[model samples]
Target: MSTAADAPPALREPRLVPLHALAAGIDFGRYFRWRHERDGDPFLVRFPGFGSVVFTGTPEGARELFRAPAELLQPPLPNPIEPMVGPASLILSRGTKHRQDRALLAPAFHRSRISAYGNVIRTAARAELAGERTGAAWRPGTRIDARAAARAITLRVILAAVFGIEESRRRDEYTTATTEFLNSFGGALFLVPALRRNLYGLSGWQRFTAARDRFDELIDGEIRRRRAHGDNGTDILGLLLDTRYDDGSPITECDLREQLRTLLVAGHETTATALVWALYRLHRDPETLARLRAELDTAGPDPDPLDLVKLPNLDAVCQETLRLHPPVPIVLRRLTGDFELRGIRLRAGDTMGVALPLLHADPAVWPEPRRFRPERFLERRYGPFEFAPYGGGHRRCVGATLADYELRIVLATIIGTVRLRLSPRFARGRMPLTVPHNIATGPHAAITFDVLEP
Candidate 1:
């Protein structure tokens, strides 16, 4: 074996040339596809001023990258998102700090705890879709913005499950604050530092900063109220508050608020986008929709939420939806020590981005990858790295179980209680926006539903 000094420098490795800023800014899924076709797997990516980054879309490479020790690899969170997720968010932290925070926060999302929230998710979904058509008949004067409705369901469910806030002035306050914060993130200014100056009255960054302040204030107030009343309820916030580090010290209020922000931002956005895609795909593919409904119907009236969660067809539909278009199609990591990845040397300072879409859509991994085939999931057992809508390894999404649970419950409730038809004008072939990270996988067309039965 060669010594470290004998190895070739990482700079000499093959690389994918940099794309212009304008090209890189739009449609990341398309960009990923183009890069995959051009450079194949483990291609180098470089952004001006951001330095060299490596992007990989192969299963073997992804597995090796994820399994690397934390001492050698670190999570690479972009600077632009730090203000949104906050400084102490787990996504932005690494090494011992990340492990400690993850440990203290893991119990809230434990399988048992997340399963218990199924009813809450169902109730939220039912309430959101109330008065919508149900049955096989087309009801006139019934149109629903699928994305907005999904957002409402997921936002409400997460608010209750994660924050333990029920319907109240405070809940409304949070909903409004979160909406404002999300709306302000649409502009390019958030990423382009030079152009971040105020424009057309209040700039995007200005609005985002202000929204963050309001959201933080509300979260802080809720934390304080819980502390004052000694309300250690079983919700995530309560669990975080009650948890103590191995040193037996409580999490700081600042850190707790940041964690809450991270959860709220990530927990709701991804689930909502997923629901949107699920609904859109179901309506477009009548055969798949019929199969799912048939599976759900076997459960009968007042079926156990847990049973609904386990329905094979329902599970397959959701899985296919995520696999075809994961809400966040890439996960970022930075090298902490010089390493050789699949025979390519990488320096400590390099960033690595895992291309989830390319990985999922690889024909070798999933035959006819572009086809929306839910049966694929039922027919095969994909390894963790093969079908990673939630990523893999230690840095995998902590909220994965909760999000999965919510998606199933909400989708089941919606399909069981509503007869949905795709809007005639629903444009096909439009690409999802890549600028705003949360809604990246959101459908390009405004998917309106005609509710026909109840």
Candidate 2:
């Protein structure tokens, strides 16, 4: 077992590249070989123009590095996100504050609590499908707004999970506003932080980036409403308001808002994208699609969401999807102190990025790495960090179980009842932003389905 006594001495590796010229447009993954070829040092890439150190190693290395997550601070977040996503975000905070913030948020997603959200999740899913059936949303002549479909379903689940009874009243209102706000960003904001100022300012792409002042107004209002009551309610906001430490100090409003905001953005976007991608995949492989449908048929009418954990095929599919298109594919960990990584010495404040998309596709670890096969995940278990789509160690995602729960329930609901397929053209060259680009892209999953009753 690794202990604190371990000293971070200088390390040299078989392949170490020094920071150099060929780092721009780096593929990110396969950086091990690339880095070795370039002399095994850190380098920069130009898509958004950032620096990174690549780590390709065992579970042991991963465990040690992440053991003290606080020690691994990351470079400053790209612009716009820094302010737009909120400064105190669990994803942005450092050291003890990071640990404390994550601690406050963890209980809401603990195993038992996550399981409780399943039934409600299923209910919300059915509502999405109900709307899809009445119109030719994705039929030959009509095109459904897929992201909108995903946003609608996920937002409801989040509201119910976070607000409980409050969801019954304001779900529709929050759905329109929140989805509109998030959908406004899509692929644009992430790829270009500089454009953020242009996009959010007055008359700029409807100029939401400058609308922070307005966002705070709404968020603060929600917090106040939740606090008026207490944790005796079911919403996570309620629980957060009521939660306290042994010292009897409750979390601050700023911290609470950041956590909630993080959940709001990440919680929906990540899961929704994954599921849409999975559906797109299902539409591509008839054999896999047939098998998935067969499995769901066996689950009977109104299947129990928790029961999905036992379905190996379903589990494998989800695993493969995550591996291929992990919602947050790139991880940024700053070397807070001079330390050794995979036998390479690093300086403090230097950042190492784990390109999970590349890692999952690396032929070294995944045989037939490019092929989409869920069985690889079932063949054996990998360490938590080794197979992390939700990250690893102490800073692992608090909502992992909830995310899995939501993905399975929503997927089972649709796959069990609907018949859908993908369009012919968009299937080719559809780049996966998330890892594990499935057989279909989310936008191409514009295919329609006819719901069948069990």
lDDT of 1 by residue, 291-402 (tens): 9888888899778788898899999999999998788777777777887676677667667767887889878889999889999999998998788898777889898999
Clashing pairs in model 1? Answer: 133-453, 134-453, 134-454, 139-452
| TM-score against native, each model | 0.91, 0.81
lDDT of 2 at 213: 43
Candidate 2 wrongly placed segments (more than 4 Å): 1-64, 72-80, 132-143, 165-169, 186-188, 196-206, 229-232, 427-454
The global C-alpha lDDT for each of the candidates, from Candidate 1 onward, is 0.77, 0.61
> Which candidate has the top score in TM-score?
1
Question: Clash number for every model?
Answer: 4, 13
lDDT of 2 by residue, 1-454 (tens): 0111222233223222223312321233343346434543232322333333445434445555666456556544442345446778877777777777677788888898888887888877777766742344333333444455776778788877775633444666566556555545544444444545553245433545434444555667788876676334766877887788657898887877767766776777788888877777766667877887788878787667889656777888888888876766555566667766666566675555555655565565778876778778779876665778887766677888988888888888877755554444534455433221111113323433333323
On lDDT, the candidate that comes out on top is 1
